[model samples]
Target: MIAFTAAEIADITNGRLAAEPGIIPGSVVTDSREATPGSLYVAKPGETADGHDFVAAAFDRGAVLALVEHDVADAAGHNYPAVVVQDSVLAMGALAAETVRRIRAAREADGQPLTVIGITGSAGKTTTKDLLAGILAAEGPTVAPQGSYNGEVGVPLTVFKADAHTRYLVIEMGATGVGHISYLADMVRPDIGVVLCVGTAHAGEFGGVENIALAKGELVEALPATGTAVLNLDDARVAAMAGRTRATVLGCTAQSAGDAQVRAGQVGLTPGGSPEFDLFLPGDPNGHHVSAKLIGAHHITNLLAAAGAAHAAGVPAGRIAESLSAQAAASRWRMERTERADGVTIINDAYNANPESMRAALRTLADLGRGRRTWAVLGAMLELGEDSIREHMAVGTQVVRLNISRLVVVGREARSLYVSAVNEGSWGNECVFAETVEDAYDLLQAELQPGDLVLFKSSNGIGLRHLGDRIALPPQAPGRTATEGSALL
Candidate 1:
């Protein structure tokens, strides 16, 4: 994203240049539709579509250069500027790494510090990233990824957004296997690494919970000796990572008494499920009490992690708590609460789901729905491999154990949940099974009453968030329904 000529980019990516050496791209893009003047388009071949097919389209949209597996001009007979490489995705990463190197160099030359913070976990990466970004932005220019852009390609795209004036970069690292996070960490070596928690979110992909811990610790492992490693004292697996990094270790916890250098005390939740707690930092006898606007008690740990990272970055404890209290949910479909005009409260947490996050959402629902009829519309938690059935059943049992009013399990993959709910003492319409989202929508429409609280949750691929969006819409007039709305539900 920093200015680079085609020749310089080719050298940075270790690829052959097929364009004039003087051509300089203003930005980088992967999708052809996002291409703008002086943009460098990276063509990646995905499972559904080959990006090489859109080379011409990208050029037509004012792209100055393209990174491809081969020169498009040779095959299509159109002379488009390109950087030929064996793999475009890897080349994009290389370019991003180089861009970060340049930004760091420029900051050092100007005698200003550039802090790169890396955050990783089985869950809560995006939420923590959003919280940390809010805290850091108060000090100077800060950049963070949009949504859940925390993967191989997404990490690089996020790094490319940084410029010379940027003081803090919050990189969310996600992994499905042992070396995934390690690979991303090598690109943007973080000065501050925050490990939220190691959970069963990707246990199946990583082979086990232990393996998930190994993958998530990669961020802390990448920190320099002078850097800071923020570890969660509550999660034993994450707490153990303190010994794995060479950086100065800072422990964060929601508990009042702990070995943690940064912690919270007198923790309580508001009626809306937002967290209120006394934030404690090192050497501070009288800590500041924070009332966060973000919903859910699960956010307590996330706030602690953000506070620890910000403290390590030289932010005052009071300012960190103040920034956190003023922050709202920046990412969609993650504890996004909406109250309908008809007195119904809809909590849409369908961005993604795993056992840990699923339980957190259920607990939040129980706490917020106290005295009101509660409905849980849940779909499958994908990538659980061997533990899928057991985890789903556990969630179903929790729904019953918590005395939630209704359990609506959508899709065949989630049938285990409904069966388990019924087996766990739910009876007579307490647990309903819907083969699709449409069926779940109809079931809710027919039975849902005023003052009911409903939660929609699932992995993003399951598409349950769309149902939450529909349910959040205002009530329609009598005998008048929008056909477009019904089509999606």
Candidate 2:
């Protein structure tokens, strides 16, 4: 972040200062526990906890400042500067935005252009952001959103990560209601806006599926007339939003991406399970082969989304393919596999879960379990609000349609998913339910067999990672090199 004095921050966030005349706040923080030297702890409140309660803890962590809406007459006891605001969370974002504007105006970092690509959708937003950054970086430097940083606070923080040296910026934009995407897009002011797809991911939060479509459309809606909008031609909802964008449209999808300006084809999985495909050049027979390290045919769609965004931003096709094939899975949870000592294969996709993601996971699980009995350990998807039960039920029906031999549903709400599966199928005796990760662990330990394939998935709230770790025993014997070293010693 650009070094800003208290006076500058007052101007940036349009807030009052309760501290001394001259203190330079070097960083902005949301979590008081993570605040340290030169940190400005923003006293924001959450559903379960208030950040103001931890002001003392932040000082212990060496924080230099505290940003608060409440007047801190006794901040002198903590020996740091304090900034008073009507809302600390909003002020933090305001300061971050102003910092970015100043950085961009500096024309620093050898005069390289800052190309920001804002990505929005119901699903595939993170994967597309990761892939897009990798592809664009094949030609030059890039800075991508870290994890699922696609919201109000995350968007500003992502911008703060930018400096003159950042050749490209790939930002993920997420929305639960109307105007969220527009707010993030305005912050990023991206050269290219990508609408990956619109689905029921958070439809309940936005009131309905139609509202969800409108929310995701906000990314392109905020685009300037000269900017480019990358639309997923295969998604009817996303495709419909294209006409609403003032930007030039570049469409992408699988070859069936009807009338796409760019498309991917000849796609399939290797025996090892990575994605392999050819990206069809727009208006030309010329194409480039992509060997992405991600698994499943769904990744082809993700790659095409990233490809179209990168192309609209002027990245070459061959470079995009090389970038896609060169990167490993950006994170372990997407479709990570672990082999247990007892010979059980575990796919740990427990980082997050949604209806679309759950369906795709089940399909992959079935394909990988061709010669083996497959088990699915599922937890509930969050943020669906009133639609949670129905969405889980939809996931359950899809599970029954797949080749899963057993289903262990963990957590409270996910029991609905298991029930739905039983109701949708012929009550396959393979279904079981556990209220907690520990219970799921005990059941798996007692029942798993060699040659069994198991998939564990859930939203972040379910703590499914604990269950995955419990069932994932270490290898019985060390690798040959380690054994040799032990013998020599």
Candidate 3:
């Protein structure tokens, strides 16, 4: 973040300042523990906790100012140094928007272009952001979200991490409603936009799958006529977004999509379960063969989207392929692999799960579990709306068809999966519902053999990723119980 005085912040956020005019904050933060000297702590209210309760702690930790909805007084009965706004989260957005504008102007005056890429989709937003950031950072200073920080507050926090020295800014946009992406785009004003795909990850909140398409398309709709919109030609909903944007279209596909500018041919998975394909760029007849370090064949869509965005931002196709070939899964629990000394391989993709990602992870598990016993510890896929039971049953059917050796379905929310597997001819101990994470852990501990491959997958809210972490450890490594880990998460 650029240097800003208390008075400047008040003016930018349309808030009333209680602090001294000369006080300058070095950085902005929401968590009090992250507060440092000259840091501006945001006292924003959350679901279970109120930020106002932590203002004193933040001040004690060297924070110079607080952005709060109300003035918080010290023990001495005097108000603490702060900027009082109607809403601290919205104020954070204002500060973030101004920060981007200042950085953009500074880079332009220095005769260097600042390329901002806004990426959105129901799934793969974080992976695509990581891939693009890796490619961009190799060329210049790049700033991107920490993980899946793509919501309202998350987007602003991502921008606050940028400064005039940042040459490229990658913003991952996520939307649960129609105007969410548009609001985020107005803040960053990206030069290039990438729409990965519209899926049923949040179909409940968005009303339907078509509404998800409407929400995801807003990223491309926000692009300028002079900019480029990278559309996934492999997905019909994403490919149709080309007609929604005024910007030039750059289409990417895992297979030949006829008119797609960026394409991958000879797509297949490596022996290690990573995707390997021949990438073909526009105006280039020759294809660059790339063996990705990231696991899962479904990642081909993400790989192509990153390649198209990088190419549109002036990177050569060869360099893009090289950068991609070296990038692995940077975020946690998204097909993250761990090989234990006991000859057991744990693929932890429990950070998030939907119909699309769930299927993808299961396919990868089946592919990698060849010649070995496989265990899939799947939890609930939330927010499917009326299709919740159907989707869960479909996943169970896939598990059976894939010939997975065992199925340990955790939680009653996902009991439909166990039922479906049984109905699909998996009998007795072949598929069982553990009813709890601890029960699942005990079952696995009693039966897991060496050379077996296990996968843990669920939505973040379900906390299966923590269980995956515990399971990835050696049987005697001494870690929190699955239930305890899930509780902590």
Q: Pick the candidate with the highest TM-score.
A: 1
Error of 1 at 120 (Å): 0.4
Query: What lDDT would candidate 3 get against the real structure?
Result: 0.91
Instruction: Report the lDDT tens digits of candidate 2 across residue range 1-489.
Output: 677787777767778767743446566677877786877777878799988888778767877778878755445553346777888767867875675566666655457566778888877788888888877776677778788877877777677666656678788888778988777776667778988777777666888888999888888888889889988888888989888988999988785847787777777888756778888756446788888778666777788888888887787777777788887778557777788767889888887777888888888888878889999999999878788888899888888888589999998878889889889772645888888766676577668889999898898778786567556655324443322322321
- The lDDT per prediction is 0.90, 0.77, 0.91
Query: Across residues 1-489, which tens digit of lDDT does each residue of candidate 3 receive?
Result: 888888888999999988662468888889999999888999999999999999999989999899999989999998889999999988988999899999999999999988899999988999999999999998999999998999888998899898999999999999888899999999999999999888899888889999999989888888999999999988999999989999999999887768999999999988999999999888677978889999999999999999999999998889999999999889999999999899989999999999999999999999999999999999999999988999999999999999999999999899999999999999988898998888887788778889999999999998889888877878754764545544534
TM-scores, all candidates, are 0.98, 0.91, 0.97
Q: Who is ahead in TM-score, 2 or 3?
A: 3
Q: Which pairs clash (backbone N, Cα, C closer than 3 Å) in model 1?
A: none
Candidate achieving the largest lDDT: 3
Ranking by lDDT: 3, 1, 2
Candidate 2 ranges with C-alpha deviation above 4 Å: 21-23, 73-79, 108-111, 385-387, 425-429, 475-489
Summing lDDT over every window of 10 consecutive residues in candidate 2, give the lowest-scoring window. Answer: 480-489
Query: Model 3 TM-score?
Result: 0.97
Cα RMSD (angstroms) for every candidate in the order listed: 1.4, 5.0, 1.8
